[model samples]
Target: MRRFRARRRQEPTNQMRYSSATDVPQVVPPPIEAAAGRVTESERRTSSQRFRGDIQGLRAVAVLAVLGFHTGMPLLSGGFVGVDVFFVISGFLITGLIDREIGRTGRLRLSRFWARRVRRLLPATAVVLVTVGAMTLLVLPMTRWSSVAWDIATSALYVVNWRLADQSVSYLASDDAPSPVQHYWSLAVEEQFYIVWPLMILLVLWLQRRYRLPLTRAMLTGIAAIGVPSFIWSIVLTKTSPGPAYFVSTTRLWELAIGGALAILAHRIPRLPAVWAHLLGVAGLTAIVLAVVTFDAATPFPGIAALVPTLGAAAVIAAGTVGRRTISDLVLDTPIMRDIGTLSYSLYLWHWPLLIGAAAMWGEDNELPVTIAVTVVGFSVVPAWLTHRLVEAPIHRAKVFVRLPGWAAVLGVVCTAIGVATAVIVSLAVPKQPSYAVGGEAPGAAVLDAIPAQDPDGRPADSVDLLVPDVLAAREDLATLGGEPCISELEGTELEACSYGPEDADVTMALVGDSKAHQWLPAFQRIADERGWRILTYLKSACPLARVDIKYEDRANQDCAEYNETRYDRLHELESIDYVVTSQVASQAYLGPNESQREQTDAMVEDLRRTWTGLEDAGRQVIVLVDNPNPEHEVIECVAEHGDELSACAFPRAIGAERGGAPAQLAALEGLDGVSSVDVNDYICPGDMCPAVIGNVLIYRRGSHLTATYVDSLTPRLDEALIAAMR
Candidate 1:
């Protein structure tokens, strides 16, 4: 007689077990095994080992959410949570496989297990990396290319998480736009987890065997011990140092443990009622969708906030019944959902780069077409399906490779090493050309070809060659470019507080503004010392000297606005400050369709007028320094492009001077009774062509900003301009 019965197992969405006698306690004790020993064929048939369609559908939802978000679609703003979904899914699947293998076999074959993993992960990853490298070279600018190359090398090594952490402190890293491979940070995290988790499971299993503890009890104990602390550390670290905490591997272990815990209980839960199973699955899927919609970058990550999706994934995975239900059967167990689930892994890998590449090509300012993002998805899916069939399936079916674990290990290491080396070489060897080069090959081809070739001269070039010097000389020319030493020998031990000035100083000159103002310091200090004038500084990073309508990069620059407003107020109250010097970043920080030159000029003039009016009212003098000419590229690059032949490379004299674009607004300022604009363009430029270097100092520090050293060298020229403006 054949007996038919349904058996169910309850597995957590995230967890793993080790293959050893100690890893898991025997489900049945030896003494009781004899009573139930005559296990009939009918009993084996009752065991539950069936695929859950709802869980697959959930995978589809998670992947699609992430894809939508990356595509820059407004609908999936919180789609980044797809990673959380993936983590849970990975945990559940890996743990279940480990547990099942360990329970059935006496020992875990490390080689066989790794081979299986390699087959699953390697081929698709290779396809993506190679494609990304090609696209990066094709689209990114020269300024952006080197960094992109470095990031690609790091990504290939699966260490991009560490790289991102190092760059976290830089303002550039947090800029609104990010690179294509930035999404690889998650892959790095997962790969790092894989390194320690398997060994940890083995150790736990061994201890259980030696101690004669129940497998369930040992697993639970280990999970609690590891998971609780990891969770706490994640919370503490995320709060204390968010970027590092988010990227580090130590903080992510618990998410995997959540799945491992699921593996521990996979054999226990009985079949749920069809109605209840469907409700649970549907509820879990809905929760995941809701979580995606709510989470964003500003939200603290990998903490308790992550639990929402983690638990939701577990709910869907554990809900085994796939029978037609009121909700789950209708929505979660559909054919369309299953197709997405099957393609989810490859889709996740391919979509981010597509979106990033699209955004880069389209320019962040332009609204990317919905069809473009959709097209990327469509293109990605075809390769993903082919890879799954041609690469993944073949590797899985070939048992001969799995039998030779050592060979598999060697192959895996060799392939990975070769790929990484190729990426490194490609990065170092590839030269960046202008975007236009790809459009056509002409003399520009020579320009493109010359891109990677280093200049024969050893010295670094200035960022901007905006000097119109009659004669150009090598950087060695300006020994006395920086001003003479001016010191104030104070009694205090504090080094920074000790003031500096001329031996017999009478006039007081104050410099204040953002980094732009600071750039002028070396020049101002030099002139002040030579003229027996005391120089006081009230400068800050990126904080321009302005009062009303203060904002930068489209956001309210509260700190800068407050700092400048307060400093101006304090300066006006001072009895001293015979001459005040300041500069600003005008077009660099603000310029667009919405922000016209007219509007910016008017606001800037008004702010200057207010400051001048107040200072003059208090019997003081104020000098308004015009905006420095920003360069399109770094000056050194210009010098290098000119083969370090300074005379051959010329800077435009018209770059920084007042122009028709803003002169009417400046005339409004000139209308003020006591205010005047000091133009430094003449002294700095001197002619139609400007030299990047004068007196041996590098002209531009970056693309347009003046370097501190070069600014120091400009003291003599700047002093002459200031004297005229002050008089």
Candidate 2:
């Protein structure tokens, strides 16, 4: 766009300035067959419409920011908000199309509209799903294969967002590997929204005809009816339940609605002056940049915090429709930006999987070298461009779909099935967990615990080739007492103690602490069953028995404190629960900020001593079960990838035990009244090296936690230690 003081001046047309369908071309929806559920709509634009280069440029910025974040660029830590930007853009474009369609036809041709969407989005998505499925088998660990398979199926049907939302809050799922198709969540949300938004508009139109109401006013009312409740729910859920809040559709509905409302009224509101448009555009761009740089993984999202980017995107869109030249014209309307924007959807789909594959192959996470990062980014564009040229563009613009949308519907089902089939194949390949333990002379600790010179049965470490539990099945190898979890969930504040052994046993023991204590139940349960002793377990995720100022989920964890206090009161009041045992995953516990490692260790030890002394005062004999060695990261995942060379994954015991709280637990009990400490780590590691597998059993699961089978092997040693500590 340009302005001149000379003769003639050419200015951009505000294409959104339509009051009636007569002002725009009528949409010709293709014929279609299938109906969708709680519809999730793909992005759509009106045919033969005026080109808004500024909007395309905005799309470029959004994708680039996301790419920057995914490709190991720390500067754009908050760039994940690019998905929010896309939602606003989708809402505005789709709503305008709906309003225009109703104006011309007096009704929505839903099947035809769905047909067009299918042809436009499904082909590219299915192609990516198949490619990712093959990649998963070739590169990723088999443990990840089954989940990624489900991810593919859900993504194909545009429901991965719901799946991710469910998983986000599950304590069991928190440590699972990230699926390559995780980014499809945003697409799922949009599709689900489009399904409902159109129906609401149709209802509003029906009411408008009966009441003689202005169409725009009725639509605005409809927008508010959905948007307001969603915004309030977003805030509440974000504060109390941040995990699910990030991925759920209900929390994000308001952002799209804001875009829809703007599309309806942008023409009605007076256009901004050129100078004001420039300033507003600059402001919006600046706001987006600031958000991209500042926000991080710990940032509570899709709540009130979302307003900055969503509103900033809205401002840019609003400011861009000024007809006169603005600051956005100089930045957003370039040829390069428009070209990238045209391939944006494909780029979004392809980039994440490529990055994930890169991580599996050579990188731990997003810590790739600059050269590797640039290569991955460059390669991602190749597939995006190829997909656009061969699949997305051709199928979307094809004449056959224009004539027969019914075929498009059929093709969409087949495409979705291909993704489901991929999932089924992967599921079928998942190695079943053997009911009985599978290799050596009661292997694991016995070999390692042997005195090197005297023990004839001891074999060299990592000698066992055949694994007891297969790598894929090791995920289910959880520590259990009577087939139930010992720990309460991350959000749980209750003191619901699970009882084990006989109800009328003469000896009653209480086990209290976090997941670290939960991991010991397999061995403890054996000890209880043999000794005819009853056990009461009070455990919570990340809530150690230590009375420390713990932080979780980016805030002060009042729940941990509340639960610990409740547990203390119960132990004090109950005379029957005379014996107490506890341990913690100290390195895993997130303490307050700005503290050195030594400072944190001191604080944790002090808290532990204080907590156990209280137990001693209650006349309860206290035994601190020493925490296991922390491999610091996922050792099972490492084993799965390098199963043949098991020794490669073996970490040093000294380092792991330090990372765990072995030293801290001992320090807490040093000369403290009635409090005794028991260490079974010698049986666990038994030497300088912490073998990834011992006695053919996998030692770690997803995190640093020990496998139940391995813990079961330590039962006799653990029982001996407990008896000694009791005396």
Candidate 3:
């Protein structure tokens, strides 16, 4: 299933008591309150220094948004923004703790602080990791074991955010099953922030000591120094690449910095008038509520759009500086709200796994129906409560862990090792086998190509228990161009001039378009090697040769069309001696937003025709290879699940054709002379039915991209098509 397309997951707070987790930690005990007229030393402290129950209320609000979003509650469509809320809260809490500690004491005790964090955060995290590890082994199929195992291990190591961020940018893994621990990315970000912020605080403190600078000014300056560039990058990167930008710490640091800045400013300014504070609080709540209801997965996140929620969270915290007399505290600090806030971290950790695991059990990765989703989240509370009571609270309050920071450090190491060990053990449990090579045993596409299946869907009756490429290994079966990846990255149109042919060959041909064009590389390379023709490959992921907008990952990918602009222009300059062959995987789903799919298809076809016409005008004979059939779901997983009944993976030809680029290819080629097109549907989907496996070969790999081994098997047919086009 597409990972988190319908919802977003966040785990930011380290569950502890309100005083320990989010309150402005007074360096000393017994916080002083001002009398009716006179006051305590203004420089010594600030207002709202007591345990802020409202911050806990903010946690409750954020986690509720998370619950609503994950459970497919329509009102919380933009619930993913909850992560920003948590980040802001965490920033305020942690930065205040550090700043206050340093202000009172000459030195900041890093070891004790880290120990406190570890004791508070690690036990529950480790428990969840072990639970997920156990679930993967016992509940999930062997096909998902490896990926999820690594995910668990990384979560244990607090690096899954990086793992997820990298995968988010990757085309091959984009549509794969999400890790149950995917929500841990926020925790990872916080952990990394935890590591960095102290150093930053120390630097700020050092600058104050060195230059005799004012502490508040230095702190604010330090926050601005880190936060300004980060916010700028967040905005820029979100526009071009939203996936990584969402998970990467650099893109999200500004939210935390905003909170830090608020903390410092709160101390410097006098407490706000009650009416203004209440107004600010109400406006802040309104901003957060507006974002939760109105924003969606399509909204560019943690960028300029993110400012609404992050600043709103900051606004709420800032308003709280007036000390709970305000309207926000009235609603936010009710017993139930504060109680939920106390349990929020555990709730965040437990909810996603239960939801994902239950869905995985039911053979789905998409958002569950609202009723069921809500039921699952509701069910999650039992474990969340149990964990909070049993694991989180006891360890957090333990003085043994607190006084002896080394013991807490050791406990963290042990927990981390347990997570890693679980991953290794689970990985070992999965059966390992070398992939089947195309030979007498695995004929791949050869058997069906030799004799078309008499059966309605050309599924040759094979009595093999195991498929060639292992089910788990199928998605990574990407075709290579020359010696490099044929498709350029999603963000850039930088094409490599990788030539595939004998160097002495006089005839030069180029294979161009999106990854659909890349899938035919093996066949074309075989043809080039045999027929003595030089072929150049220019392929970009989701970028077609057409000049139309594309909607990928549910957002309008302006980059794809913009990349095409630069690419098609450069294609005009590649006055290479001869032919330019191309294909596309573009479907109605991939086309830019329009009132109707027909209009989108027509506009796409027009642009595709224009693109092809230009290539033809450049003295290059163009051969458009008709795109292949696409199944609604990935086939290998189905193949794995129903090894005894492979027919479960077959789909109707009509459905497959509509999902592929065949209709668009046919339309673009119509009424055009000198340009030839070839349809391999007879081989790919025989007798009006498309089967997942044809002639012992898995037809599709990632998304609709054809497997190299299968494409290799169709070499002779593609050679004939190329020859016919030349004729």
Q: How many residue pairs collide in each prediction?
A: 27, 6, 0
> Which 10 consecutive residues of model 3 have the lowest summed lDDT?
28-37
Candidate 2 lDDT, 599-633, residue by residue in tens: 77778778777878887887889898888888845
Residue 422 lDDT, candidate 1, scale 0-100: 52
What clash count does candidate 3 reach?
0
Point out where model 1 deviates above 4 Å.
1-48, 172-177, 268-279, 321-326, 364-367, 430-727
- Using all chains and alpha carbons, the TM-scores for the candidates as numbered come to 0.66, 0.87, 0.91
Full-model lDDT for every candidate:
0.56, 0.73, 0.75
- Stretches of candidate 3 exceeding 4 Å from the true structure: 1-50, 363-367, 434-440, 453-458, 502-506, 589-594
Per-residue lDDT tens digits for candidate 1, residues 1-727, read 1111000000011111111111112221111111223333333223323445655666777777777665556646566677777776666566655655565454456667776666566556666777777777676433344566677677767787777665553332322235566767767777776666667667777897798766667767877687778889989876655556666666777877786676566444334566666667667777787877776554566687878777777677656433234365466568998777767766666766666667556632223566676677678887778866676556655676767666666656765765576577656654443211122211211221233323323222333233221112222112121342221111111112113575346888776554455556666656766777887776554455566544442334444555656677767776767777666554222333267766766666666667668777877777767656654333544454453476554545465344212242254467775766666654344445555664444465443455555555456557767878776
lDDT of 3 at 145: 86
Q: lDDT winner among the candidates?
A: 3
Q: What TM-score should be assigned to candidate 1? A: 0.66
Decide which is better by TM-score, 1 or 3. Answer: 3
